[model samples]
Target: MAKGKVAFVAHCLLNQNAKVAEFARLPGVVSPIIGKLREKDFIIEQLPCPEILAMGLTRWWTTRDIYDNPGYRRHCRNLAKFTADLIEDYYRRGFEIILVGLDGSPSSGVRYTGSSDPIWGGRPQATVDQYKIVPGKGIWIEELEKELQSRGIPFPRATGIPMDSQDFDMDKAVKEFEEFLGESSGVQG
Candidate 1:
């Protein structure tokens, strides 16, 4: 029997409706990336939206520092554990899996997670500018990484799909996915 290939994607990547207000870029899934993955015979699994699960859809836009609290961290950890366990099972079954995240997101950014230190650190309200993307994992991604490491499983490097209201670069996302697939194939070969 032929083993299946899978890609675990950020929830909002597959469903823009899951994103917070004013953040969704498309009416539905990120089509280009999804199309490429489908062409490659990848089974797409959309991860749960951590923020939506923890805080309702009406939740305010906050920084990672605010969500770095104990309660929210616990929620993320639990979600991570469940996701990791599922991935581990797939690994054992001879399936290939890749984790895909959203860049600049507070909960799922792979390489450039959003941070609002200056704003949340008691700066004046006027000085509180928009959150900036920095080099780091988001709250949920950090928990997922930790969970994967604890299970003695190699953490799959994440590919970031960037999306904003004004700019939705499907070509960039497709390129990223191609690079990721090439790297994974090279490793297996």
Candidate 2:
């Protein structure tokens, strides 16, 4: 059997339309990175949007603390299990799996996820500017990482593409994606 490369990407990376109101950086998919992934023979798997699943699209802007509740945590754990299962299956088949996440997101950020200094306790009343973006894992990403660790899945450490800026930089995102893939393959960017 021929083995294929696979990548698990955050949903917003593929569908900006699913992002919170006024938060979408691109009109459609994050084409630059997606284009490069396709060129690299990677079968991209778009992970489910945990926030969208838990709350509707029109849900108010929130921080990780708001989603830190038991219910939301359980939901994230279930989603993580499902994602891990797929990755494990691919790994067993001798396929390489790479995890990609959106930076500065409340659910999928890998490196610079958003968080509240003091717990917000609920959705923000003002705009997203009221909250701060910190260097940490988003709720779902945290759960996913834990799940992968528990399963003993030895995969490359996940890489993040910036998507927090009000004006998203496709060029930067593409460059980051290339650099990440290159590093994973022992090739310098």
TM-score for each of the candidates: 0.87, 0.88
Cα shift from native, residue 120, model 1 (Å): 3.2
Top candidate by lDDT: 2
Clashing pairs in 1: none
- The backbone clash count of each candidate, in order, is 0, 0
Candidate-wise lDDT, in order: 0.76, 0.79
Report the Cα lDDT for residue 85, model 1. 79
- lDDT (tens digit, per residue) of candidate 1 on 1-189: 327788888998889888877787789887887888898898888888899997878866766777788888899999998998788887777677778888878789887777765656443352224666677778998898888889888777567776631354677667867888778431010
Question: How much is 55 displaced in model 1, in angstroms?
Answer: 0.9
**Candidate 1 error regions (>4 Å):** 121-129, 164-168, 186-189
Model 2, global lDDT: 0.79
Which 10 residues in a row give candidate 1 its minimum summed lDDT? Answer: 121-130
